[model samples]
Target: MGKLVFLSGAGLSAPSGLSTFRDNDGLWEQYDLDIVCNYQTWIKNFNLVHEFYNKRRLELRKVTPNKMHEKIAEISKRFEVINFTQNVDDLLERAGCENVIHLHGKLLELHCTNCNDITKLNLNDDLEFKFENCKKCQSKLIKPSVVFFGEQAPFYTDLYSTFYNLNEDDLVVIIGTSGAVININYLLRFAKSKNILINLEKNKYINEALFSHIIYKSCDECIDELEQIIQEWNS
Candidate 1:
């Protein structure tokens, strides 16, 4: 049997006191989307881009992993779980899940715009309120490693390799994304594996008939139900 591949999104972390990107009165309402999230603004005002993610980094200090995150970690004990998450947060890692992959990138890591060397920022380190400088080299534009509005996801090479090697018996579960940014076809072509979706609502971009199951509920609740099934199957 193949491993269980989980594709998670913002909803997976929302219960842990983080907000999803597109919800009403969410991040878009608080910040200027064009300035904080777009590429045009990054070039015009790199400092603003830095500030935007810097604030988000600080916010992570207040949150903790919730039941769903812990449960997903527990799943790893029973099966090989490749958690492919679009969220920038480290909630899954904090929840003790091994083998978690961030598709969009991670907020806890920074990259030098000039050298492109990645630095894993320490959550406990009291970084000055200003943008941090690169440690390896004297590079100026050290920014969060996240995939921004115009940037292609940097992990596609690894993702493609994983999908190419996916077995037909592998279970693919997509949760929380509304089909906004990621090209669903990119994942679908290689997912000859069994497929399912767990979301607050049906994803408009996906053909409903394609999935083996569709569960409309909070990801936390759906995962609880799925866990029961898995436990029974194992027993």
Candidate 2:
């Protein structure tokens, strides 16, 4: 009957053979961010945009859910859990969590850039989503469902409403993300009575005083500690 909100980020998916932009030699290092990840680039050259996301989608296909995902799935059973993820991967849903709120659009979906008509990725015999011209619109503009650099997340209004509507009794658990999309200051200001932060390493953006509990440990270690805490509370 209680509620818990999990605000997760790229870090949640990193342990599962995924990488974040901040990691050394990570995905961002290999490409021009402005050209592949920006809305302006999509306008000027859709091919570049397609090329980048195709590689990302292929990379996603090779990975599997890790301990972090399994642990979070276990947490889901104990509370009325609402997951807000900045990650595009479906690993959480794959791990048995449901109704995940993807702050960033997903990699496995496609859309008509002109009409906002979204669809699942269209894969060919090679197991890749083909980005051809948009069939739904005569304009023939098609794009990945992801939120480009200059675009507003489609669900910002819903996310903001959830933040403000949090009851004082609700527990908020934030994992992995650096709070880039939603700043740390704003989260601290709008947080319900209790908040927990779990990250593999220290983020310079975090103020230790703001979190009820600040956990800095490896993914496996964090999972173990969290499970133990949950057990104790249940007992």
lDDT of each: 0.76, 0.76
With a 3 Å backbone cut-off (N, CA, C), the pairs that clash in candidate 2 are none
Shift in Å, residue 203, candidate 2: 2.0
lDDT of 1 by residue, 1-235 (tens): 5688888888788778787667645444667777777754675778777777877888889899988788888888779778888888989999998778898888988788788898777779953236556777877777678887887886777767777787767777777777677655566775677777777887668666657778888877776677755554345
Best by TM-score: 2
Residue pairs with backbone atoms closer than 3 Å in model 1 (clashes): none
Q: Which residue runs does candidate 2 get wrong by more than 4 Å?
A: 24-27, 122-127, 231-235
TM-score of 2: 0.90
lDDT of 2 by residue, 1-235 (tens): 3577888888888878787667755566868887877886676877777777878887877788888888888789777788889999888888899888899889888788688887775333243546566677755677788898998898878777777787767777778877766786576676665677888888777777777777986565587777765554345
The clash numbers for all candidates, in the given order, read 0, 0
Deviation of model 1 at 160, angstroms:
3.4
Question: CA lDDT of 35 in candidate 1?
Answer: 78
